[model samples]
Target chain A: MFTGLSAFPLTPIDEKGIDKRAFVGLVTRLADAGVDSIGALGSTGGYAYLSREQRAWAARTAVEAAGTTPVIVGIGALRTRDVLNLAADAQSAGAAAVLLAPMTYQPLTDDEVFGLYEAVTAEISVPLVVYDNPGTTHVTFSDELHGRIAVLPKIGSIKIPGIAVEEAPGRIAVLRAVIPAHVTIGVSGDWLAAGGLLGGADAWYSVLAGLFPETVLAITRAAQTGSSAAAVAASDRLEPLWALFQRYGSLRVVSAAAESLGLVNSPNLPLPLLGLDHAARRELEAALVVLGLN
Target chain B: MFTGLSAFPLTPIDEKGIDKRAFVGLVTRLADAGVDSIGALGSTGGYAYLSREQRAWAARTAVEAAGTTPVIVGIGALRTRDVLNLAADAQSAGAAAVLLAPMTYQPLTDDEVFGLYEAVTAEISVPLVVYDNPGTTHVTFSDELHGRIAVLPKIGSIKIPGIAVEEAPGRIAVLRAVIPAHVTIGVSGDWLAAGGLLGGADAWYSVLAGLFPETVLAITRAAQTGSSAAAVAASDRLEPLWALFQRYGSLRVVSAAAESLGLVNSPNLPLPLLGLDHAARRELEAALVVLGLN
Candidate 1:
């Protein structure tokens, strides 16, 4: 199930809470575009800023709206009990798999993190994807720790942060040799998806793909078919957008992009996290058009 | 209101929910021992690991148990709406002040952090303490950011993380110069409390003082009375315990210490945060005894 382009859509928020209408439309669009999987509620989905009930509804909605496309729901929370409840919610909602980042409040020890995975993996029925997004979750997983969690039963994939394009091959090889063959490696960081894909990552767990599925699918397909030049060209074409993602973070950049594209309501992000400012928003809108992503 | 030793006790939890009886006993002990204030749901209280209802209950219980002693309730949450709800709950519960750490899932910018304080400070009736806890919150506040937020209406204090004892004098002096005279500067990090107090800090925001009130009170009282030598000596006596705190985090070390001292039920911490292992427990018990903190 962990292959090709997996689109992680924004779980848009309005005054009421999860704007399910906007969320469903985003998921349905990804499925209709023929992306490999729908990753609902990754960091892009603002999973941490939600309540258990809200997260459960979003998980169920993503699975229902994705139709034939598999849905991988992000079920990360600060507490193990909460993560277990979320995992149960996602699995019962008919999610194809579950994504878990070792979300932290107090800094975690390697042992605590491993214990968290062990406890959850022991209870859940579906395959689990180990989400390693240090920028958001603030928990760094060492290669040895990754190797340990990767072998646990139901571990379907490991979504790793991007390495430099030049270092992707050797780095992925080093990681690939340590973990089990059955566990696929999905690369995140929209800007680094090409290097990760060409460097032999099995899937692209993407943020922009949620809004612009066709654009990323082109890169994924070219990489899958061994058209390195085509993949690089496609990725290079979106450099301007990637620059904005690097500058404002893909979540904020895409929240603005989605609003500008009329895919979601403005002020869509959960509060305490504002949307991009006027200049960044204008720049993003122009980039979307100049890159022909509109 | 934010001065002297503010004892931050654990809001102990059990199978059903908050162990209110245990929590009340801890708060009562702090109040009875003549602590200057009670910090209800600080990081040591596991504020990040609770629901709005649970936090509200904890806040009410602490204020009620603290009697006339001022109680500062921690009102940090990942969402601004939740923080506002928590701040309102704490205020209604008769809390004297609120502590807010800029909690994050997506790492926040300085502007966003400032915006959070601005938004919350506008609404809360009680004074607010800016909790600059990077270890748990993973969001660092620059001195410039602290200076900006300290001027916001209702800002009573800023609780800065500890620096080296040698650096404390100049560090506190620098910060003291920036913030308004009414806004007290409190220093956290149990090991550095002495240096902080002697270094011209207005208060010691302490974890150890929660469980061992008399122990840290001696140091606080010594510092308050201008007995720098006595304060240093008192802090020195607990050097072994501080060694454990530095080795394991103060929260974990204190959780283990609390359990050993029969302050609460075993496994007092929130889920996913296990208490110290057997060896650490054994070491902790020995340290408590040898240090005469038993």
Candidate 2:
């Protein structure tokens, strides 16, 4: 039911734990920026580091702050039962929909992959978005597999990452051609929004929108209204931020950007992933200035 | 404290849930074959396909049938918490040791990989084996990371797969040289046992042992007891089974052999992975006949 720019806010964490105030503030800011929807516990939100209980709390907080805006909660886990559990929690917390990724470590055969989605979708009462980010999750769904899974009942949309910028349009075309008219396709990058929209993606799942939400919203509105010049202008201004986001190549980069914007106190990532290095921070600062986001 | 040939038996499943009676029978048969230990719910044992509750039941059943012989429970999972929980269940069920692989799916940084193992090992009270099967897990423990994790208390062994045959000796040497004396380096493969043992591996984890445990046990015992002639003879006799197992490049072939021997009925695998094809089944039967197991 949601459209336009959907901002996936960076989860704020400090030495004590998840900074609830900062997270709530972030949700409020994105809502004011005209974000069509907000997503929590996504890759940008560092869902892998959060406990199930923490994820549930974050989902609730985001949904409450989002008010009338649709809140899509990412429900990714390695096991089918865990994913189902998260979906139930998200549904209980009043999330509008749940974004699901395939099992991360164990590569499932096409049949197994379809079966996993079927199992998860069957358990949840909420609308589902089948997230395809094979770069992080080693397993990828083929076009045929995606086509089969799209026909399932509860699936509402497909979220495809924009890293494969050139391939994304074709991928989106394949998905659009197969999935019914009711199903929407969302792009997960800023730089490819113009091309993605042209290729049939219904909306943008914007990470940069967390920092400059209005700019992305304007671009999405312009693109949807068939104003090519307005969409290009907006995309041009956001390109620097998009490049910076790509430089770090990890989820922590989004949090680092949040810290740079003073939206969060620290870029303190959970153990295992080190915070952004000095060079990366400087690059981010330069890009922020270029995009007028600093 | 146990060593030599260890067989990870396939979990039997007929139309009626888990075929516990057939599983117990298979264990009893392996015990009679002079197998030194039993590995349960491991990759070969279809741990990924079984539900968590089913996994616990299988572990318990295997432990009950194992008696005094050591039972090494496989505790691999995508999240550290799940692995820890599995380890606790395994310890409570009386498993002798726990074997775990690193987080798969997302390409983990070296630090994340090490952190995952440390988190699981810290919580486990019993001895644990770090099972490094990069082929399936898509993540490898570098020699440096292995050395760091090997120092942890209760860390007892390393299971290096045979695909890295050439590197096995060097890796074993590094682990042996750096880790405490109590930490054993073991190799998993039918043909690499002799070289691995010669290169200082303390034991072997063999799939062939499920079908021809006597032959594998004899070879390992002969090698351990300094009977080169006996070891060579035993290895020669087990060659056909090894060749058959390698043909399909999957562990299901081993399960098919178990079915051929009447150890378990119906080698019906879970969704995604089909059972042995016609040619593979015939080859397994032929190999079993040649190995005198028929």
- Best model number under lDDT: 1
Over B117-191, each residue of candidate 1 has an lDDT whose tens digit, in order, gives 999999988899999998888888878998999999999999999978999999988998888999999999989
Report the lDDT tens digits of candidate 1 across residue range A11-79.
999656877789889999999999999999899999999888999899989989999899999999998
Could you estimate the TM-score for every candidate?
0.98, 0.79
Of all native A–B interface contacts, model 2 reproduces a fraction of 0.25
* Full-model lDDT for every candidate: 0.91, 0.76
Q: What DockQ values do the models have?
A: 0.81, 0.26
